[model samples]
Target chain A: MITFLFYLPFILGFVVIGVWGERKIASFIQDRYGPMEVGPKGLLQTIADLLKMLQKEDIRPKAADKPLFLMAPLLIFVAIFAGFAVLPISPAISGADIETGVFFLLAVVSLDVVGVLMAGWGSNNKYSLYGAMRSVAQIVSYEIPLGITVLCMVVIGSTLDLNELSSLQGIFTSETTYLFGIKSLGIDVTQIGGILSWNIVQVPFSFLIFLIFFIAGLAEANRAPFDLPESESELIGGYHTEYAGFRWGIFMLSEYAMMLLVSFLASILFFGGWNTPFPNIGSVTMATWTSGTPGELSGAIWGAFWLIFKTTIFVFVQMWVRWTYPRLRVDQLMSLSWKYLTPAALILLLLCGVWKMLMV
Target chain B: MDQMAVYLFYFFGLLAIAGALGILITRNLMHAAFLLIAVFLSVAAIFVLGGAEFVAVSQIMVYVGGILILLIFGIMLTNRISSDKIDTGFGNVLLGILVGCAFLVWVGDYILTQFNDQKAALEQTNNQTEKLGISLIADHVLAFELIAILLLIALIGAAYIAKKDKEEVME
Candidate 1:
């Protein structure tokens, strides 16, 4: 419940900063100033937008399915928000301490497809239906590779608990950690304790897995390059085309929250989540100073700092890719998932199994 | 805590039944499909209450996420059924009620007879996923392998049928 409260405000605040940041970044990319009038280089621009949105009358189309249409935004928000319940904010703080935290998060987030379908069908608009269908298809298709990539990490980590996964990749782990997870090399990086012990460094092939996970995550979040669902050039505003006022705001909020959720998962899975990146060298205790033992208040603070730091970097990359690339054609999107990503993820899964065997 | 668990169990059990009834009565196919999701979710909740977290998550993932989406897609793509109202013809109402009542009675009888035994067995278990995994690999390996092969064959058959239809369309 505490984590729930923290995430609600956290998501709202992140969306505010994210919207402003995206605009500023896009403007800079196009050689122009973005939103300089609002408070402090337009930091309060989203708040202004929110106030304007709140005052606008909520409109429902005559032909729309009234209950489903009204229910769609709330359902979408709830489904996405539920994914955060399993997110380990810090070692001491997690929403639900379920043994299958990773799987539960994946399962809960995928429920948003039902909400998307409701929005599309209930709107009684052709464009909205098209957008929703495309969105669901893309999400469902991409989830295969996403699930496979995550399964690869699970195989390597041998645990589905996010907190346990975090501990395994940090200095606190008691087990011997080999370079690239090959026991023959016998260079234990457990004591070194930094990026060296991270999954990407410990299991080099997982870098490729991370890339697959990132791409799948992007598609799942409905961000650009895979934003065919909301391609404004053709589909108008997509699934939420019939929505107005704060309902539209809910969709936008869910999108940003989904972005943060994916970024957090990626960092935790591959980047030694909440663990400091600086290794302890001779006469230097950067790792120890940066990260405390789990359950300590200092640990929670430092953990959140590093996790948010990595997540911010990923979020920036997502925005960068969004602005840089053109939206994928429908066929191109399907082919990328079924032909390329899924097959690659499968092979990577097999390789990860071998890596796990070697580690054992 | 145990009282809370009992209340949750009853709540989800009633929710599942209500959702199923909603699906039966709804004239709109889309609304029925959505109500089916409610049923699936409540059943998952019931699984959670039973201490089967792995099964509960899988229930949501497979039923709510995969199968229900496919069902919705089927409804959407079918021009005839996509209309606002579906007849869902009322045939053999008496027979349906008879079968339903008999099945309910049988299930109730079995539950009443075996409840204490099952409760005692369940109380001894923890980390259901690990136990499930070990049993799947060690005791039920053949059954697991057979199911996997069956699913793989079904997937290939589906792809083949879909591809054949695509080729016919092109021709």
Candidate 2:
């Protein structure tokens, strides 16, 4: 019920914000104010962009797969929007807070690959086909490390519930410290890693894995660096190069929508999701969590307010990353993943796993 | 009045069932792919009526998005000649239709009577994504890992094949 409303606003918000982010990113990089002429500091840039795309033509090439050509855009939009069923947008502001939320998010998210493949295949252009194949290979290769890193988080977190992980069951203090039966005055490893022992902070090596995973995600989602699929400079609007109108808009919007979804996932898995770094900056009674029958608002339906607040902060961090980075070359991109990221992540996984076993 | 709603339900049910059978009976492989898309879209509608919005979206996404593309690509990459266009003869078509009709009749009877005909009976559908995720992690974790192995094998095989062509060209 409330989840549907959250899904709608969340999608529309990402679609609109993404366009603005893109314009702002361009201007910031070039040292000139982009879109300033469109609205108050180019706020209406997305609106103009939308209208422009709307008036454009819808051209299907003669040699393309008819059914699939038409199906590509719709499928991209569908898969991107579908992951919203599990994101914790607000305390009382999500669709279903399902237990297996994390896994579901990943499954629906991978479905975006199909849309990319279709856009490439259905275009019947050599560049689009090549770009599509390349995109799939890069995305699939990156997924292994991304997934392994995520699995590391899941192993530590134990439960797949986003909200549960966000609450931080693993917090430890100096008084409670035990390192082979010695309590230290200053060093609390729990404070360093927490209960789920965030993969990034627990091992210095995991940072490389995190960086690789983030970059790979950026590429897989066709957000610059790996955006050769839509490389306007060379392929002239690669993959869906010939697409026009709402279909093109949907593809672009799906990209932004997925960026948001993936960032939310990143936050959940690594950044303690919605856990306030400082404890008790917010706290709710179990009654509120189980509100309908109780003394607090746990079930009070507004219990998600804190959850949404933390998740959004993580989502914003993702936007910050997107605007900050420049594009990557194709060969460089493959090397970065295969030569550097993948091997590093595998080693981290193995070492961390063994270390975990030793400690236990 | 209640019977009227049941009849209305049967009308759309007929549309879905008949469409599916038409797909099975179609002679053209390309035509069959189109029919399957129709079947998938209709099943999505059914998933909606069954109160599984998420599953409905996934069914539409996976079947309509992924599998249909694969089927069409299979059709494209293969050189389809007259052999692929051969039709089942009249007697064979008649016999096939009779068998299909019998199967449908039996299934329809089962749907009406033996399944306890309860409105709530429609709710056994799992959250499609979650169920799939659980199976990936818990029951089929090995199989899921095997998917990785399979993909790696495919990538290598494709690379080897492509390399052989390159070597031939160089020679």
Candidate 3:
């Protein structure tokens, strides 16, 4: 009982904070003041939105499948909330903290697609059906690349444990190299000469895989540029044309939650999870930042601060991409996934697995 | 908490079985696909209970993310079945249920006789990555390579077929 109560506020805080963060990100990229009209630089904009959503009438068209219409919103919210339940914010600060954290996170997040399909079906509209079908096809193809790329990370990390992997990245040794080899210029630099070594520096090809995965992830998450399900111009809000009030709110919230989840994943996979950037400064010199204090309400909350900072960078980039790029047609989306990302991801995965084996 | 978890699992399990039956027996392809999602979700819950987290994740990714989408695409492209109704005979339902029940019983009996003894003693464990992965590379290597080949073939075939279909439909 205490645990559930303890976690609820944090969850709400995360959702509220996400809106603020998004506004901040928007402003930073576009050079315009965003959301200042709300409260104290739009800090309470999320709250106002919540209130507006609450007061708005829950509208369902007479043609809508009433039962499914009601259930779809709950399903979307539940799957996303379930996704967050497994994402660790800090050391000892996770909801579930299961050994297979990544798997749970992946599974719970992917379930979002089912609810989208249901929403489309229940509406019984043509655009809804088109949106739903496109969504299905898009997700199906992109998921292959997403899975393979994550599998490559699992190959590198040697464990599905997010914490373990992050901690491994915390190893700031100057001598460590990717696959324990110096085959970059056929000169064996570490053995022959001396130089700096990082995973990004050593296994540059795998890092290239990570970039592909990140873009593919952006597509997979169905954010802007890939948000065919809600392409307002084309499909008039796409699959969710009929949704109003809280049901619509739920759909919107699910999307933002997924956005945060993916950004956090990027952090864990590429930016060393909650671990700091300077490997040497993780635990010792960064005591002020690494402490497990909750709501210290301080100038610098290290663990949460670093994690959020890394996540913010990813989120900002996501928003930048969203604003800058034009949406791809359904055929283009399909071709991009099947023709390019999937094969590339598979090859990268194979290379990494072989690299790890040879290193061992 | 243990009792509550068990009860929750059982409730979902029952729902899964009912959904699976609906999926198998229903004539409407769309409804069956939705019901199959329910079955998949329930089975994922079972995987969670069994501590097979990676398996549960793969189940969602492969089954929901892959097969269900394929099923939907199939329904969309097919011309024979009208969206209004799919006529399934009552005889087929009865026969399907009976055969399904028999298969279930046989599988149950085999599970009980063959694995019950060992399963009782063995405890639920975590970290299946190494074992499952080893099998993927060692035992399922041929199948893995074949999947690659199959995907390549399917890619080419889908392109060719969809191209023809596009021309026909455009005409």
Q: lDDT per prediction?
A: 0.90, 0.62, 0.70
**Pairs with steric clashes in candidate 3:** A289-A302
Q: DockQ for every model, please.
A: 0.64, 0.10, 0.46
1 or 3: which has the higher lDDT?
1
Q: In model 3, how large is the Cα lDDT of residue A246?
A: 77
Cα misplacement distance, residue B159 of candidate 1 (Å):
1.0
Q: B71-95, model 1: which lDDT tens digit per residue? A: 9999888764226644466789999
Model 2 Cα lDDT, one tens digit per residue, B61-164: 56765567566556645643212332432457788879989999999998888767577665556555557667778998998899999988997898677555
Best by DockQ: 1
| Residue B29 in candidate 2, Cα distance off native in Å | 5.3
lDDT of 1: 0.90
lDDT of 2 at B170: 91
Assign candidate 1 its CAPRI class: medium
Per-residue lDDT of candidate 1, residues A1-360 (tens digit): 855677888888899899999999999888999998889888888889989999998999998988889999999999999998877777677558787889999999999999999999999888999999999999999999999999999989888888789888878788887766678887877877888889999888788999999999999999999999999999998999999999999999999999999999999999988888998786697888899877899988998899999999999999999989999999999999999999999999999998787665
What lDDT does candidate 3 reach at residue B54? 76
Superposed on all Cα atoms, model 3 deviates from the true structure by an RMSD in Å of 5.0
lDDT of 3 by residue, B2-49 (tens): 687789879889989999889767876667877898899889888777
Candidate 3 wrong stretches, greater than 4 Å: A1-11, A14-17, A20-36, A94-99, A171-202, A279-301, A358-360, B1-9, B24-28, B51-53, B77-89, B97-105, B108-116, B139-160, B163-171
**Model 3 Cα shift for residue B17 (angstroms):** 2.4
Cα interface RMSD of each candidate? 2.1, 6.3, 3.0
